[model samples]
Target: MSSYYGLPVLKEPVWKVPDVPAYLYLGGMAGASSTMALLADLTGRRHLARAGRVAAAVGATASVGALVHDLGRPARFLHMLRVFKPTSPLSVGSWILAPFSGLAGAAAASELTGLLPVPGKAAGVLAGFLAPAMTTYTAVLLADTAVPGWHEAYRELPFVFAGSAVASAGAVGLVAAPAQARPARRMAVAGSALELAASRRMEARLGLAAEAYRTGRAGAVLRVARATTAVGAGLALAAGRSRAAGVAAGACLTLGAVATRYGVFEAGRETARDPRYVVEPQRERVGAPGSEVRGEVHRSSSDGDLQ
Candidate 1:
């Protein structure tokens, strides 16, 4: 019934600390590394498998540490596991993180100690099965919120997140297990392609809501991310003859993935900061011609005493 121009209709996200994005980056690395470990095990690439398992364990553990630090207290992290709510991403994520961490830790420990081979291999398999959910659920968590950029891009965010995950894991593999860099290179290229395509589609479809991602600091960061991703993917696919080339490609991919996460988070903040993003859409939806007329009449009658 009231004009909302230049007025914020919703609160921005409270997750302003650096830890949140760090957590997201580390979690993606863990999930993708877990998947790589599973594939390497199946293919009997022992070196690569060991690298993936170690990466998964370290990344997952670091992610949890970030989450706990972000919460301002360790107990809040513990509190998240008090219940298992299927509908809540954070709840489901907590459960997913718990088991995945254990499995990853087990796989890494066994690899290091050269003991308990059978159970460790089983844990790796199970962790791989849960890897997709671990990597992509954070997208759902962000999308479920009221932030315009995040909510509007829900369709493609999962693909974006997954692609970033793959690129990250591939970068780690390239550095940690150079002997088996072929698969990592392939994954990086594929992931970069998917991320670029999905991001383009998301921008094309978002209309006015997409402005947050196209202007200011967020825009610059995203542009750099895209450019780096393309360059990294090209180098990775072509780095067959030189070790230096492989390292450069892997470094670029890792940087691009990190930039993507930060850019996405900043874009969401930009959307929340701009009132037009919130007000104009609601105005279009609720202040159509007929609705505007009815609203005016109601307001006029309510002010009859003044008249």
Candidate 2:
């Protein structure tokens, strides 16, 4: 094997901070808000339903702005939609985001203006249907890349993102609509638990490749996120009796979710900088006893274990 000690195994992600993380956070909130709107409408919680719709619209719209800004040009984003590739997460995500933005905006407008009630309800339903993909596809987009921190955590990343989405939606609902507080609290607690568990599991499963999550600035951010998530979820579960407690819980959840996004982004970049993460695992895979063929390509069967 050729030895190149200082060379990077993969290119660092070209995405800028704040912009990419903002896009991720807003996209997730958009999806979660759509789900909240649907659930609130079904349960006759009009205030929450209206707030959820509005939040969905705002989040979706802002997400597009963040995405376009990150792309550095509106034309590039427009060009991305020129083709639909089933295997390309960016292509599929763009398509999902487009309809989702329209539907969410329409639904919120109808609620705000009290016009076209039937069409608004239909739009909300459609947005809810698309919300899962909107929230989870970001995870898929990251995992589809060659970054060790991302691709190696594919299995758990979806759940982590989904949980964060639900938690964020719950936080927004709690802060925006007092009537649906109970369900919102429940969602926050459940979502935080899921996020924490999935993150720990992903790190554990990554084995040696998980260093990016353990020993750097990314690790510090993730550590804070875990602490805040735990504290926030605990407070949320017990926040029913006091408005102050509820708001505090909501703020913590929002903070934790943002921290998680930044930490994940940083971890992926850090992983790409280290060559051992790229070479060692593949080397072991190829050298394993009873391997199919000498120097044959190795496919990992371990869940979320990347190349």
Candidate 3:
């Protein structure tokens, strides 16, 4: 493999560390919390439902703040809402975030204030309906990028994200309303299992791109994430009405989810910084004798169509 004067083929992501990772964490938590709230309400766990609503509202608000801070201007976010492009994950994500934030806020307010109960339930339901997309769209956004680590893992990224979201929401429930958190315990156990399994599969299948997740800062955080998530899930299963144990499990789960997001972000950045992640794959695709010319002709026609 070779590079153009030893330079990275793709530009490194400009997204700031804490801001982008925080947005991903909070958005996923908010989306899953909304869904959990609706489920709790249906199951007659009023306290748990209320807690979920509040968590969703606060998470969504903070998520938006983090995003706008990264963009350096609120107008940039508003500009995203000016057009809805289904083919573009960013555009679709903006639309999902806007309504989800509003609905989550309304649901939380209604639940807390005892006013407009009808509208609050309606808002909660609608937010729940949008929750899955809200939780997973960030994965799509990441995968759509040119970064090898992220793009190559697209097949399992959504599952990893969704599981993390659910686990985070469960953590909130455990922390906020442990007395009525049976459903949360179940979610915590199930979500963590799914996340761990999907993540392992993604890494195993990533080939050379997996180097980004196996070395450097990304690897350290991901290792911690896996350990904490597994511990949290085990603790959740044995908690069984023990408030202290539930809280401990919740804390561990929250840390794991945060670490996972940060690790993934760092892995993507690492891939962009290394030229091999770019050159080696293309070389393999066009390695055979006479294949380079044929590949160039195919790419030329594809580029023409795209143009």
User: How many residue pairs clash in all the candidates, one count each?
Assistant: 0, 0, 0
Q: Please report how far candidate 2 places residue 185 from its true position, in Å.
A: 1.0
The lDDT of each candidate is 0.87, 0.88, 0.94
TM-score per candidate, chains pooled: 0.91, 0.93, 0.94
In candidate 2, what are the lDDT values of residues 1-307, reduced to their tens digit? 3337777878888999899998998999889989989999999999889888999999999999999999899999889889999989989999999999999999999999999999999999999999999988999999999998899999999999999889988888778876577778888888898999999999999976688898789999999988888888888888875778888888899999988888998898887888778888877776888767432433443443545
The best-first sequence of candidates by lDDT reads 3, 2, 1
Candidate 1 lDDT by residue in tens digits, 78-101: 899999999988899899888888
Best by TM-score: 3
lDDT (tens digit, per residue) of candidate 3 on 1-307 = 5577888899999999799999999999999999999999999999999999999999999999999999999999999999999999999999999999999999999999999999999999999999999899999999999999999999999999999999999999888898998999999998999999999999999989999998999999999999999999998999988999999999999999999999999999999999999878776767766797667877888889544
Highest lDDT: which candidate?
3
Which 10-residue window of candidate 1 scores lowest in summed lDDT? 1-10
Span of 10 residues, lowest total lDDT, candidate 2: 294-303
User: Model 2, stretches more than 4 Å misplaced?
Assistant: 1-5, 293-307
Cα lDDT over the full model 3: 0.94
